[model samples]
Target chain A: MNKYKRYERLAAIVKIFNDNPNTLINLEYFMNLFGIAKSTASEDIDILKDVIEKFNFGKLITVPGAGGGIKYLSISNIDSYRSFVKEMCEKLKDASRIIPGGFLYTADLIYSPSVVSKIGEILSYPFQEKNIDAVVTVETKGIPIAMMCARALNVPLVIIRKDSRVTEGSFVSINYVSGSQRHIRSMSLSRRSLKKGSKVLLIDDFMKAGGTIRGMMELMEEFDAEVVGAGVMISTQKPEEKLVNNYISIFVLKNMDEEKNIIDIEISDWIMGE
Target chain B: MNKYKRYERLAAIVKIFNDNPNTLINLEYFMNLFGIAKSTASEDIDILKDVIEKFNFGKLITVPGAGGGIKYLSISNIDSYRSFVKEMCEKLKDASRIIPGGFLYTADLIYSPSVVSKIGEILSYPFQEKNIDAVVTVETKGIPIAMMCARALNVPLVIIRKDSRVTEGSFVSINYVSGSQRHIRSMSLSRRSLKKGSKVLLIDDFMKAGGTIRGMMELMEEFDAEVVGAGVMISTQKPEEKLVNNYISIFVLKNMDEEKNIIDIEISDWIMGE
Candidate 1:
């Protein structure tokens, strides 16, 4: 192939790895797809690694020997995380977003593919070192973010539904007292959705009193799966007593004065190195 | 600042555009972020377009004059679509996927990020030219694929829930006869989820009688929205009389012989240029 064609192949390989992050792609697959030799494929990957490093994009790991190939890890640097949180905090500060009962309207932001995918990258970073079999979340608002995290981690997303459906066959449902309202709420997972002894990372959109995450943990226990970690996009400051501990959050909602139409928010101290 | 740094910047630019497909990104933002001159930013986009074209990755459009910048279109070549469909059909043919009701268990495949996202790309390609304001789908199984198409189209995903919740404020519910069993089923969308007079693209996981898509179209009519197009990942061939027409599907399920433990499936003829 000519020099330009080689450049095209390099670009294509980068996209394939990016699309399937954390998944191994054998060198032979690429060589056969592009009609190139093993050495040429290796050279292309080397160029990709150099560019990714200089840009601080992410890590490209090359497993040696048999049963190994190239894998892309979607880990963003601390600066990138800080910038993302800061920008999101600014967007959330809009007075109009404060609906009745002080709940910030964030459906638009969470559904935006670019924003949610970036949030997923930041939230998935700390848990990447752990052996996660699936990324789990409750139904409705958290699906997009959890889906992105699952994509980044190269794992399946298991959604815990508020109500079980006939289409899902048999499901295991559990009820727990919500931390905020102290009301009994139930969450269920399809019996076949998760495997016993598998490790799961729990994710959510907001963490007020950690009621939902706590409920999800209990549900995971019923499946005999280990809760490896939990993360949320935002957590309110007033909820001093959280139902769950050791959860990571990107932003902290300090206060929301509905009467005065003012909201106080900041990027989480975790990203600030505080 | 340097040659290597320029290469890194190019890679980052490509990723940013790829992540936020079909959204206009102003050049000034790039210039300020990279601390580069206007000419340098323009030159970087030129290089990206060249690489993308050689690989047939997608198109990078540059708008001129005021309110102009650059945008990326994530349209993969037809060959990529065929390969994706071919591989997924093989995965679906496993005998174990057949459930008690003869319904194929595809929750795992639909939730797999890499596979779903590729399906999203292929499905979103035809609707990219339309004036689509939102990508809509019914709850649970269709969320992941619909989210991907919404991402590709750079629109918010408005999910129609099977049941209403107080958390969503007000909702508009509708009942329709599901084509497969001719059973009356109801679906609802949050009142605030969609805007009046907006264009929508409908997406789903499976189509047995096209009842669900037709129901969605009726629901969209209530919201004063337009249904520009509909697409599904799989559709059964036995449903000779579909409830709706003019929809795209990636795969066709020819037959499922439960007694003989055999399955017949193929990539849709639409993808084969038939």
Candidate 2:
């Protein structure tokens, strides 16, 4: 095998880290692959550490001792995330996006892979250090965003179905009132979806009265799982208080006038570090 | 600003390409970002090209014209993809994954980020050159796989909801038969989800008679979109005649004796280039 150059090794290392984010990798593996010694591997990692920091491409965390290795945590600077949210707010402000039921049409934004992946990265950043075992969401709209968040955090995604399906085997179902609609709805999750006492982060595409997320939290109780954090793409400002506390929303919908065809949305104060 | 070393620039390029796969990024953008000359950027690309090929990460294509730039197309070697599918088959052959009513419980595998992302990459590889405008899938199980496929193809994801909802504004709904259960069901897509005359790739997690995928194909007709291709993670073998044709399935379920607790699954022959 031909020996690889430092730049070539560096390029390959970046790609590997990018491919498997939040995954622990042993230096010996790279040492063997690149035919390099421990000293060279350490130097390459040091250079990569500086490069990631300079570009705000997240962090490369190294642990010492046995059963220890390096892992990549994908986090972006506040400004870039803020700018992305601002662009989303601008797109959402379009009056044409309003539906008949006073709801904003956000499917376009949430469904786009490029857009939602960034949303996922931003939403999952805060909970990266929370030791989350899984990311949870309800069926339908939240699945994409939640999936991306799960991908970013390097965790499994557990989706709670709106209605019980026969295909999922044994499941746990619960009925909760839809906060905005005021109708009791049932949600279900397979018994095998989570292990007991697994720490999870909840994610959703949109939130209004916080009923859905609260329902998810309650559903977590059935599995004896803990909800470490909750995140939504957008939440209305009318309900200053939500059913659950300590949740994050990327955008706050302050007002949407149906007749006037106007919408006032902004990046959430929490995201802006206010 | 401090001058970046050649290796540092190579590392940054790999990270950028990984972040925005299939995106046409201009060389001027890199030059501006790194304060490097055109010749230096060319040398870096040459090195990255060699590194990516050696690592089997993917391809970095450079277009040489005013409207042309460089884009990353994520494609793995056939052996790697075949091995991934083989591993999936091994996990799936476990009798415990069988559920009542003869359905396989695949939520855990389909919902996994790492596993599903690879499935997405493999599924989207063939369609990459087709200029697919979006990846389409029905809601629930297929969303994660479809979303990752869209990510890999660098296109938007359009999810067809099983039931029409008020939040999506105007939508076109269609009723179709579920091939496996032979039950009539309705699927809907928002009017604004796809542009007219766009080319789309249909993806799903599993198919028996392929009724759901056929339903998606019919729904695509309403928007005047062409179905360029279709892919599924797994398809049953007994249904030799499927509702849809010209689709790719990564795995073929040869037999599943529910009473005997046996599942014989294998990587699809096409993937192995049989």
State which candidate has the highest TM-score: 2
TM-score per model over all chains: 0.90, 0.98
lDDT for A42 (candidate 2): 92
Cα RMSD (angstroms) for every candidate in the order listed: 2.9, 1.4
Runs of candidate 1 with Cα error greater than 4 angstroms are A1-9, A26-44, B1-10, B26-47, B62-66, B181-184
- On residues B1-274, what C-alpha lDDT tens digit does candidate 1 reach at each position? 6344555666677767777899989889888878888898888788889888766778888888799888888885666567768778899898777766777888788888988898898889888868699999887788899999999999988888776552555679999998888989998886777899999999999999999999999999999998888999898998788988879888888899888887788888768877
Off by over 4 Å in 2: none
Please give the TM-score that candidate 2 achieves against the real structure: 0.98
Candidate 2 per-residue lDDT, tens place, B1-274, comes to 4388888888889998988888899889888889988888888888888889888888989888999888898885566677788788899999998887888888889899999999999999888888999999998899999999999988999988899763677889999999878899999887888899999999999989999999999999999999998999999997899998879999899999998999999888878888
Candidate 1: Cα lDDT at A158: 90
Candidate 2: which pairs clash?
none
